[model samples]
Target: MNSKKSKYHLLVLMDLSKASEAALKNAVHLAKEINGKVEVFHVKSPADVAKYENQFSAMRAIQEDTSNVQSKLMKLIREIEKEEKVVITLQISYGNAKQAIKDKIDSVKPDLVILGKRKNNLMNFLEPDITKFVLKECNANILISGEDNKFHSFDDISLGVYGETIHKEGLEIISDLKTNEEDPIRFFRIRNPNNSDKSVTTEQNKKWAVSYTFSEGENALDGLASYITGTNTQLFCIPRKQNENASWFGLSRINDLIYKLNIPVLILR
Candidate 1:
């Protein structure tokens, strides 16, 4: 195992929406617990500014507009900094939200990136694409949050394990988290009935807090969804196995559940 001090710097994507607000709060909670700094990021499109240029002075409006948003965020950052003494910074950029974030990820090199799940039903089809884009592009760890996830400590962590071989990377990442000895870590062995491996029983021998369940045929994704919901899992981890079926981590049913889970899904590569 690699040994090094763990230092966390978080970058949270915020558009000032309700869902973004929730994502920011969750990021703050984690930062406070870890004594880490946070960067509140916002992206604007040039076309958006041009659309309103005729009505308002472009330069003045842009500065005033960004300042208004920054002022509110800075106020919140100050309060959190004063109360928890954690450092927080604001970053604003122009262009596509997804691309802007990717660039920021390269420049800032954040340990973890927190993004809000799209809450608009009308744009449901488009939202998952952005999530998939980020998952594929960003190299650092990711935490996807929905509006329902409020500011709370991560007391329970659930690791969705396919079998023994594929989840070793995830275990390594989990070992690095700043977790107390008593914090419960649940290892969920999601078995496929067709496969006779049944590694769950063998895995149980290695850990005390292990749970096993088989995926219901055709309804496997729903079954796992219900499991996460019942567990009220604070942080859910899954492996992003490459060249796998959609069930593994592709842009399909599992992707759908990733957005619907309402909790942070930490993708482990």
Candidate 2:
């Protein structure tokens, strides 16, 4: 509480999953680099218990449930703040998770939204998955932390460039996250053998800091997975849309990669 107000605010979404905890811890790690603070937000649907809200007994039950969750979040926040030497706060609400997150982004206007995700076989069937919803609906930049993320400092970072316009902006965004001026960031240039016209300019390559081409033999997702796993890259930065037309990797490919890759990816909007 005594820490000075943070200029950068990171809003993290916690679903109480193991991934959520990793996201929060990782958010704290990122806060140090960005001079940021963390705000953990959890949302639940009360519709199941709404019918009983009219009943005094059921209303008490709902309130108790909310209170218990609040207590647990507060405890977690306190521990993280104390250990990380950073400030963190929690926000809890009951509603549709995706919509609630969108509302929070609008109201709080955090610089970034950190989301935790695990390998989900049912992601395709799970309508309105958090990653997809945020990518499409929310305007805030997003960092998706996989359950197995180590939350280490971003000593080694990679920016995946799938195309020209959308991806170039990612370089500028990721630069703002680095506290260490000497930190190295190289490009994992995704060669879309299909599109010869789309490529990174000299200026982008310079802004990119360095470059590494994705293996042409490998598919887009495969190359990305290989690079992230093969290198010490702790964080991967890329834009949500691969191109102006939003042709490919717009949602499905990136969403699929999120569940499969156990690394943190910052998807710029």
Candidate 3:
């Protein structure tokens, strides 16, 4: 845990879309609570301009469009500033959306990158979704906001421990949260439901509130959701495996959990 990097820099990836608004609102509230700065970047693909060159001969039209995006971003900043104590910055780039975002993440070195998980469609297949790409590429932490337009507090956090790798990183991240006496950590473990004869024991030192469930259904998301809804957890923490393809302890469980749970998710890499 790096206590020296207490102050967080939050980058909100936006496109002035409805989903982006929800993400930005949640991010602004979080930034205010953490006393962090907020930056919003809108990405415009240069390929789009090239493809439309026949219809619009002037390159100035594309430049004006980029400028308009920056103006809109500033307006959003002003609106959020009225309600929260955040220093907002705006950026606009013309290139690949994912690459532009990655570049910004590298240059700004933000503590966390906030983004909205958009629906996947055929048109977006080749260009892969930015959120998914960020998960694979960026070294910085990520928070994927859902359609639910609400603010969340990390008063009660749940750690979905399945293996040693996730367990170790989860514990470290939870410790770094600096939870007060009022708030404590909660733990949950998933196992086969049919193994009634088998039992998983939790260490006493790391024990807080522990629950075990047999994942009777094939869907791992259901098992995790049962715990989340049953316990009303605020944040869910999981670890990313070093190997991208292998799933020794079911790393895909995190992806399922992310898609099902509406709350903030922490993926420790």
* Most accurate candidate by TM-score: 2
Per-prediction backbone clash count = 0, 0, 1
Q: Against the true structure, what is each candidate's TM-score?
A: 0.78, 0.82, 0.76
Off by over 4 Å in 3: 1-6, 50-58, 118-128, 154-178, 191-217, 241-252
- Candidate 3 lDDT over 198-237, as tens digits, reads 3333232434445444443566557667777677666665
Error of 1 at 163 (Å): 5.4
- Cα lDDT of model 1 by residue, 20-137, tens digit: 7767777877765554567888777766665563655766677777788788877777876686655667987777767887898998888788877655321121233666777788
On residues 1-269, what C-alpha lDDT tens digit does candidate 2 reach at each position? Answer: 44776767899888666667878898888777666888888887776445674678777767888898888888888888888777788878887777787899999998888877665531221234556778778887888875574665643344443334434445455655543445445555555466554444434334544456643343667766777677756666666655432555557766666665666777777
User: Local error of candidate 1 at 1, Å?
Assistant: 32
Candidate 1: deviation at residue 199, Å?
Answer: 2.5
Question: lDDT of all the models against the reference?
Answer: 0.62, 0.67, 0.61
Model 1 / residue 60 / CA error / Å? 3.1
Give candidate 3's whole-model lDDT.
Answer: 0.61
> Higher-lDDT candidate among 1 and 2?
2
